[model samples]
Target: MPLQTVLVTGANRGLGLEFVRQYREAGWHVIATSRPLDEGVRARDCGAELLQLDVRDEGAIHALAHALEGRKIDLLINNAGYHPGAHQLGELDYSSWQTAFHINVIAPLQIAEAFLPVIPPGGKIVNIGSRQGSMACNREGGRYLYRATKAALHSITRSLAIDLTKRGIIVVALHPGWVKTDMGTDSADIEVEESVSGMREVIADLGQHNTGHLINYDGAVIPW
Candidate 1:
């Protein structure tokens, strides 16, 4: 296959940055978008196009859509996320919940919709997801907003799979495992490199049979 073009949101740091680095190293033309381009140099050095994007902004997303007109994206990683401290169930802030919805859920769907025409057959969409959002895996209840948002993401992935199937684009949700990124913290079992490598493995292994699935970084199926 020829070189793939990929876009990863939140590419300035953490798993997003690692994804940009690994994909670029693997010879993919990467469009790495982050809110602040000043912090995007590392991704740029890795052969990525550092793009200005705030997923919360519809205008920015639309602008990107226009800029990429005539371009075909082989893979799109909806990796940007936010977890506010006001995530406790009983003490939840309605504002934080809204913010979570905007970034963690709405943005992914909007991006997919805005760029739908550019994702050709055999293209892939990997929604960076979490086991924390899994109702089957939920052991605690404090992170209400974050959990709800990610669970919604899982739903979005499945729905997109159905909608994009006719177009021959494969859409699946991926749990990155507990990797040590800025979001995962130091105690997180896997390293950023390890998680990205694992996700790449999973992506490379995906086929028609795997579309609409919720999988871990190791390619294990995660219950809905």
Candidate 2:
């Protein structure tokens, strides 16, 4: 049988890079996307087919989809995110907030839309959402831009799950936790390996019934 193919966005470093490494190690065909040309090469070094993509660019997404038309995509992971500006209630840059929304929210949905035609039945889509996104789970709230955009991602995740159900596609929002990445920072609770491993397990077990759920890396269901 042919290896299952997974397409991951922003796969140059951090969680995205780890996803590529894990999947490749597990004998899957990985298609990794990054913005920089050197980063693309790094993805290639990690045993993935590299595609240069800036999630913010809709035309590039469409072009990639067109280029990969007829190819089977077993999984799509939208793992890119941008956290901008101060989280303080009123001390935010409006422009940075717009950028955060564009990168964190709109881009993932656009990428999903572009690739929908080629994803085979039983294909899965995992949006790398944040626990901060959960309105029900937000206790300390303040990271306005990041939080709002991730919340929007969860909303989109639910919609995609419902809309794609008839076609046998599973869509779910995944929170990787406060991982030790640049975004997560050095003070985070868990390492990249632990988080990615847990998420990989979650991905492996996903089915139609799991669609639309907000799942933590450790397989716990988070309130939406």
Candidate 3:
């Protein structure tokens, strides 16, 4: 049997990089994409097929879709994201808000739709979401832009899970926890290895049964 093919965006760093690395190490064929594929030596060393792709770039998505046309992609990890300055509710920067939505919410959905047909039955979509995105746990006020984008992403995940079930594809939002990445910052509680390892294990074990659910890296369900 051929190895499963997994494509992960934002592969230059953080969780995306770990997914590519670990999947490749497991003998899967990994197609790692990033805005600057040339700069990611770590991803390249993982023996992945590197592609230049910015999630916000529609043309790039189409180009990539065409490049992989007719091939069966078993898994897609939409890990690309951007969190602009933590804009308070009233003082929000409208431009940054739009940019965040473009990258966090819209781009992933567009990428998935653009490549929908090529995904094989039993394939999966792992959307990188956040706990802050969860309406069930939105306590503090502030960071409206990032929170909104992720919440929209979670909504998209639920809708797509139902819409794509006929194709036997699984779509679920995954919160990688407060990871110690550039996005998560130094004071984050979880290390990158711990977060990614837990997520990879849970992700590798998820299926159609878990579609549309919001789950933590450790496989706990989260309220929508």
Best by TM-score: 2
- What lDDT is reached at residue 130 by model 2? 92
Model 2 C-alpha lDDT per residue in residues 1-224, reported as the tens digit of each score? 67899999999999999999999999999999999968677678989999899988899999999999989999999999987858887797778877888899999999999999989889999999999999999789688888899999999999999999999999999999899998999999999999999999999999998899999999999998
lDDT over C-alpha atoms for residue 10 of model 2: 93
Order the candidates by lDDT, highest first.
2, 1, 3
**Clashing pairs for predicted structure model 1, backbone only:** none
lDDT of each: 0.91, 0.93, 0.90
lDDT of 1 by residue, 1-224 (tens): 78889999999999999999999889899999989999988999898999999999999999999999999999999999987777665777887778889999999999999988788899999999899889998877678888889999999999999988888899999999998877788999999998899999999999878999889998899998
Which of 1 and 2 is the better model by lDDT? Answer: 2
Model 2 scores worst on lDDT over the 10 consecutive residues at 37-46
After superposing candidate 3 on the true structure, give the runs of residues whose Cα lies further than 4 Å from its correct spot: 89-91
Positional deviation of residue 157's Cα in model 1 after best superposition, in angstroms: 0.8
| Candidate 3 worst ten-residue window by lDDT | 86-95
lDDT of 3: 0.90
Clashing residue pairs, candidate 3? none
Best by lDDT: 2
